[model samples]
Target: MEYNLEVAELEKKYSNFHLKHINIKLPKGKIIGLVGENGSGKTTTIKSILNLIKYDKGNIKIFGKNTNNLTKIDREKIGVVLDDSFFAPILNVNDINKLMKKFYHNWNEKYYFEKVKKFNIPTNKPLKEFSSGMKMKIKVLCALAHEPKLLILDEPTNGLDPIFRYEIVDLFADFVSNKENSILMTTHITSDLEHLVDEVIFILQGNIILDIAKNKIDNEYGIIEILPENISKIKKEDYLKCLKYKNIYYILVDSRLEFQKKYPKLEIRKPTLEEIMLILVKGE
Candidate 1:
């Protein structure tokens, strides 16, 4: 399969944290979500992949070229929106447009302004004066104006209201409508990811614990609540994780149908991405 971005055995070390041998493959025309608790290395992994920070070991390839060797022309094909990174606070919409044009060879000035108008972003107001939601929208719009093949975003929908969130989600859907485009993003908002992503990757304490397609998650994974006394009735291999609270056990099983066939008395329900992550990270 052709991948727009590839990371293999990527490792980075810090005094307090370590990102260990992370591997990811983002196929063309799909959106992948990187999710984990705060301080679990989600942002660290992204920074490493983008070469914003140095990795001690491993390879990163974008558009089939090593990230270390990507030329200015190659870099132009990737758009990025970082959580804490953006243009200077003093730059207004027009000032940003002029500056970006000098940086990106394929920058679409007309498209950028059209988005500005459509989103009703203040053309003359400095970025510092904009609301958080407005700032995020402008950043996203700038990323899209370059018409990149791959979009790397960190919390792209962080501060928007429901209405604007829906619009931004729709815009993302349209971006990957072309078979050549792809997106990789990290968001704390699992609900948005539930509707937007093709696959979800769960990282915990610097390790990737799960990587699965959205359909498989929806169709195969399940959650069951049972009394603590019934725990032994469940085969160890049948369940992926188990959480205990008071007198009840919440179990995460990989195959709902098969587990149901085995234990007909226990109730099984579909597991959401957030629920699954909770179980994996906090369960034993």
Candidate 2:
């Protein structure tokens, strides 16, 4: 019932893009995955929540305090891993630690060093010398060094290998086990989310189209494959969305059990997060 982050009627407008009436409620100890296409305003919504940009309307609360009013201490409780934001390329791992120590009161030097060693990141090489995956690891480690209560990450696993991605995901699982911490992350990798997130939010063209528990998607939602010619056989209320490609039609239904009972001959299979997003975004 308690939420770590809440957004109501959030709106932002640009010359060519608009984020409209965005609302999100991230409860304590839960991981929420945000998914959308490349230009779907994911970054814009995050920036708005962090008060990094001006919004035309809406209220954002982090730890029950307005984002606009968060003091330095309040901000310290949140960790952020933005895709394009980090230390200067010239800073090495040691230099980054030294710099961050001066910025955060709770910076855990021992923990940070331990993770750096575990991740096998080089201490002497500048960030520019690290590979993209290595850079991502350093950013994630830095975000975790301060023991933040809420993590806001933008593609934190973007450049990691499967092995490291699994490790990072495990770390996230451990982080939220306390039930006082939470995470809001946006990733193109829906497969990771399928096993990691407690809930998922789907955004399309700057609008939040779906926000549901991951289990609901796994247990209740289903996809039905049928020939286009048989589409008329399905009642409109039975399916949430439908798409046609080549010779087949893919229909998404929220009540898979009932739908299956209604049309026993129809092929109904559980929907993955990616499949659900595809249908919601492109299906009619």
Top-TM-score structure, candidate number: 2
lDDT of each: 0.91, 0.92
lDDT tens digits, residue span 1-284, model 2: 99999989999999999999888899999999999888898899889988889999999999999998999999999999998888889999999999999999999999999999999999999999999999999999888999999999998889899999999999999999999999999987888898889999999888999999999988899998898779999999889999887778999999889998999998899988888888888999
TM-score of each: 0.95, 0.96
> Residue-wise lDDT of candidate 1 within 101-186, one digit each (tens)?
99999999999999899999999999999999999999999899998999999989889888888999999999999988999999
Clash counts for the predictions, in order: 0, 0
Where does candidate 2 clash, by residue pair? none
Model 2 misplaced stretches (Cα beyond 4 Å): none
Error of 2 at 108 (Å): 0.9
